[model samples]
Target: MPAEPLEKGQTRFALRAPSARRVAVVIEGEAHPMNRDPDGLYSAEFGAPAGTLYRFRVTTGGGEELEVPDPASRFQPEDVHGPSEVVDTRAFGRPDAGWRGRPWHETVLYELHVGAFTPEGTYEAAAGKLDHLRDLGVTAVELMPLSDFPGGRNWGYDGVLPYAPDSSYGRPESLRAFAAAAHERGIQVFLDVVYNHFGPDGNYLSAYAPEFFTDRHETPWGAAINMDGRGSGYVREFFIRNALYWLSDYGLDGLRLDAVHAILDDSPEHFLTELARRVQEGPGAGRHVHLLLENEENEASRLLGGGSSDSVYTAQWNDDIHHALHVSATGEGASYYSDFADAPVARLGRCLAEGFAFQGDPSQHRGNARGEPSGHLSPLRFVSLLQNHDQVGNRAFGDRISESVSSEVVRAVAAVYLLAPQVPMLFMGEEWAASSPFQFFCDFDGDLARLVTEGRRREFQKFPEFSEEATRERIPDPSDEQTFLDSKLVWDERGDLENAEILDFYTDALAVRRAEIVPRLEGIPGTGAQQRLVGERGLRVQWPLADGSLLSLLANLSEKESGGFEPPPGRLIFATNDTGPDDTGNLSAWTVAWYLLENNS
Candidate 1:
């Protein structure tokens, strides 16, 4: 904790500046000297109440002086480059005191960006929409990162202040209100957090505390966090405290760690392991506090306990299933999608039965073997999604998956995942198929802005369609304000007749899941789930549930009719199309059906 409120209306301010000869707290243009301890931690107590603007002025050993905001600032009212404000975490009161959160097996996630979720793009506006999500049967709402960034708008991966909620959305109290509102609607709130590296700009840790980062380990953003180097104890504690702050102070139900593979560490006890353990012992001791990961490595070992109360992590974002489904529906085999293009239906079946499609299998994209055997992990250990922020926003045009495939194909894919044993997540506006694109957008100044624009265009140059200079130049500039505005969701589109039909389809599928599937998902073992191919593009998968019942899926994922398959056993639970299998055992193109068979044993 960088700042703490003490008795008698005094505040204790602390900063770790080992390389500085002297450090002072600068409040209202006055410099108050702080006492330095043996470990180079400077501390001082002052009579400062909440909302007092302040910064730290440090004099280096060479006699140069500089000022910077607190690294653990709770709120940045004027954005990342401005002075931090004093915030009392206990000031805000939560209305939903009895909210203990939902179980992992009952989670139906609806991922949304706070800035693009509504027309106002504020936390208050987002809270007003909780009723809509509850009506659509969303059990949880997963928000993209809200950390303070350098500019007015960003995808939030470039956050610099880990503790502060970006002021562009609203005050910290607004976020608490948003969570309370969702809890009132029986919706758990989750946040996406980044701990791999600091953002490219507005980070001042290297100036006073150079040991905060190290060149021994490198990442895409440059030198990795000093998690294993000398003076790493405090660095690890810094991140662990940040995680607890969000969970305890803000009352967030869970956290989705972004890109954990890039968090390279050589310590005997990995930072992730220690962080999860601390969280479980701290705020998670009472309620369900889930910890999720987005590791490209597909390390199933990290996801343990089959969604049990004692598990370190609840689930992981299963990208293998997404890629396989994307390739099968869109027939676009470019980039990483090529890994599943050869046998997409087979891969999809594998993901449905087992946890991952590539369990220790060779990956063409990485030129190496990827993932461990995930067959022993329960289906509840995986979170299945068709489109997330990365899947839609990282593209050159940021086109939603609904735009590339037919509505029938979209509905079929939805039915397959929404009713499956694994947890299902939907990107915002995916149910109604909005027309707006979630293009990558940001607000940076001058040279950095130009570099970001050019870097984004350069990333797509390897593709054949973007090989031409003119085509590449047409790519949207991330720094343009219009790029951010254009990504906002069009709320009116959901009311249109065509889009409403799709919304109804999604609503009904989720209703069926809640009523029929979620109750039986608790004790389903990882093994005994089997997959058999009906034809080139047809898949049949079955899983033995906890109640001794067998849940099944029969999907024809092509544009042509698939024949020579036996009718699925048991009663039909849900189907994408109106018609069922014919007497000749042929399913219509782009059709999916789910069935349930009660066990007499």
Candidate 2:
């Protein structure tokens, strides 16, 4: 049931509870019984002002009474178990009316966690850093989940309350302020939202509406959300409303859906397709909205609206690029990396030439074909990243690439994604190479804490490094406060010479990319960029320009220098090595260089 807004100080509340025998709206210790309709919907009108705290007193089918917050609450001052506050978005109003968002193809995204990005760990603190991101050439900031989870610290994937911003990160107005600050600087903001499963703690939907979940499908977390069973219409409406709330109320530009593959729905119109249509052609029309998915299944059809011309998502996260790069850099192929182990460099080249490496190919890691053909899609339909939260935090030690590989190697890898045609995303500390690690962390108390720690340890047991007991002891406890503290980015380190060198490399690369590639991207060949393997461990990509010129990037992926090769017909634009153009045209180990060729050659 929707919470309808009336006059300034009034709100109309309605709830649907078929199993509830009696329901009352208890506001500030006063009880008001709501009138019920024949369809099991209870309605009540209160003289309550904004910020008034209230909850529902629900009498169960068997006469057991329970007190729970509203399923559609916009704000929870006391979190999940406490009273829900009335948040009138109509009161605060939209901050940036001139903000229509930026072009999706021109976007250079920077993903960050609000808590670990700065020492203050609040929306206000994150907003303070917008100038820094603007200077780094970041067109948008993709924040990790901010939905209200159980405790003070979390990765945000375990959020239970989809509507309320976590109390730990200030109030609802604080988030609005952050979005306003970003838009004022011409930077768009997107929120990462989880719809796969609710957090283990503070999930009250099942307590009142068991029909919200179904045993027909099982997710890695637990029972899947009901999208096609009895009572699924309201369940579907509940999530779609949450998406609209964030975009219209908080002024967010887009949403990065957590894992769409696990959202098992068998309806005539898929949930994601329906969500896209509502956001694009519904009330959100005339406002630019981007929808991105993190679907591991690599279903290219989703980006194409499942072959329907009416619906479409903006893009999908391309994990094949990350896995191939990881195998090439670390040279450690054990679990999922086994598929890319044989020809890691070639795989990386293919990913650059094409959008995905495993498109319809049999993967040894999965023992089956993993992805569908993605050749017919635009390069902008895939988002590539070098280091994301999952790639770093899921590690046994949560170590960054700066700690695992050589500095020169890291620079080459950075140039590959930043200059490629696809959309590039940078993790929080990747630009400056911050020393802190983004480890797996949570704040669960009592027995839950112990169980979470044990589960984490068991997850890493398959890795040969964590097979021994002593090795397991070294694994940081996910429940410890120290783990969260250790993950905060050290902002001061950006000024150091070692870190500044890497940061400058990224800034210059992005500048050259915008100047050369972004303009002529729309009309590129359907086969994507033209690329050829250079010798044994080298690759050269030629991006066609409108003026009949080419933007060429050459790199040596091996540890030894590859010499005696003629340079591409162009003036050198960028090189990872400190030196400029050489007499012999030799490329050092783990070096990448970009050049611009004119119409002459």
Candidate 3:
């Protein structure tokens, strides 16, 4: 929760600065000394109403005085390095009164970055497109992070203030209105949140409260957060409260925790578990509130028996499925793709039938065991997709999967995953095969800008394609304004004949998933999915549904036709190329077919 408002328009302001000898709340250029408690918390009461701009002046133990924005600021109107503004959260009227959220089995996520989603690139602008998303069969809109970052333009990962939404998008009430607009259209809204590390710039916690971080564990960014070290209880409470604030105040339906594998904690009660328990007891108690994760470790224990009332997490982004699908479609065997290159068809089958392809298996890329057994988990616990922000933006050119493969191949892969039992997600502009590339762009200046641009190009130096200096220079600089402009989607392309056909293909597939598959997913057992390889690039997988029926998929991923397979048993529900198998038990090149077998006993 944010700072509580007291009677007579007074608000209580508090800051944890145990290492500071003196602290004062600077409101409207007037400083008021704060009283320090035994726990090292400085507190002050002021008659500051809503929209009051203030900063904290702290005198450190070394006798250095500096001003910093409130760590729990509700809104930062002037980017990260400015004064924080008090917001009246209850002023905004609710958008929808009848939105109790939908079930997890019916989630068809459309992930989008608010900046590039529309030409206006504001919360109100994005909300206007809910009709298009609803018409395209998107049940939920998974927004990239909105936390306050360093500059005007960012991917939202480099955010410093977790409580403040970047002002470049819109005001805090604008985000609340966006949620209300989504709920009116029966679309659930989910936000991506980064809890592992803060951005490199504008983080003021270490200066006043060094105990917020610990040198015990090292992360990719820096020293790990003090989750299990001394004075860790308050640190954990800060993040947990942040999560609850977004869900309760903003009326968001769900949250996607980004890269939680880096949130190292060795306490008896893991932070993740405690957060989930608090959420389930909080806002989640009244309505359906889903919690999703992005964990590279493929930890199935956190996702066991998920999407139910008693589960810790609802689902995880299944990178194994995406990697296998990308390797099979494009035949690119570089970097992490090498793990799935040799037998991409087999690996794809395993990912579709079971939850993971590397269940307790050795990962040649990492030179270690990668995952736990996930065969007993329901496929819905895995969120499957072909392209996402990291898969596309991290590339030297930020080329999408459609850029590397034929349209036929893209259609075939889309057919396979869109109808699979796993929850399906689509990257923004993917439904129409948008031509714009989602390049990595930022708005850092001076030395930081140069370092980030150089670092971006250097990351691809190990690849043979970018080994030369000339080739590396061809990669766009992350700080370039044109790079950001080039990434915006061209809405007019949807009306083009070729793009419209692709859009229609996706619409039909998602419609089938909603009408046929979502109804049978409620009580399906986790252990009944099975798979078999048909030929070199052919796969046959099936899952027994809760209603004693069977759902099956047969796919030929290669450009060559595959034979020596009997006709699949079940009534054909959807197909990419043909209606059924040929007389010689042959499936055409790049074809996918889904079937349903009814139990007539």
lDDT of 3 by residue, 1-601 (tens): 3555677788888999999999998987899999999999999887988888889999999999999999888999988999998787877777676689999999999999999999889999999999999999999999999999998889999999999999999999999999999999999999999889999888999998999999998899998888999999989999999999999889899999999889999998889999999999998999989999998888888885733333589899999999999999999889999999999999999999889999889999989999878888888899999999999998888889989888899999999999999999999999999999999999998999999999999999999999999999999999998898899999999999989999999999999999889998886788888899987799999999878889988898988888855566778889887575678978888989899887662
Clashes of 1: 0
**Which runs in model 2 stand beyond 4 Å of their true positions?**
1-5, 304-311, 522-525, 545-549, 563-565, 578-585, 598-601
Score candidate 2 by lDDT: 0.84
What's the lDDT for candidate 1? 0.90
The TM-scores, one per candidate, come to 0.98, 0.96, 0.98
Cα lDDT tens digits for candidate 1, 424-529: 9999999899899999999999999999999999999899999998999999999999999999999889899989999999999999999989999987798999
What is the per-residue lDDT of model 2 for residues 226-270, given as tens digits with 9 covering 90 to 100?
Answer: 998998888888899889888988889999999999999998888
Pairs that collide in candidate 2 are none
Query: Model 1, poorest ten-residue lDDT window?
Result: 304-313
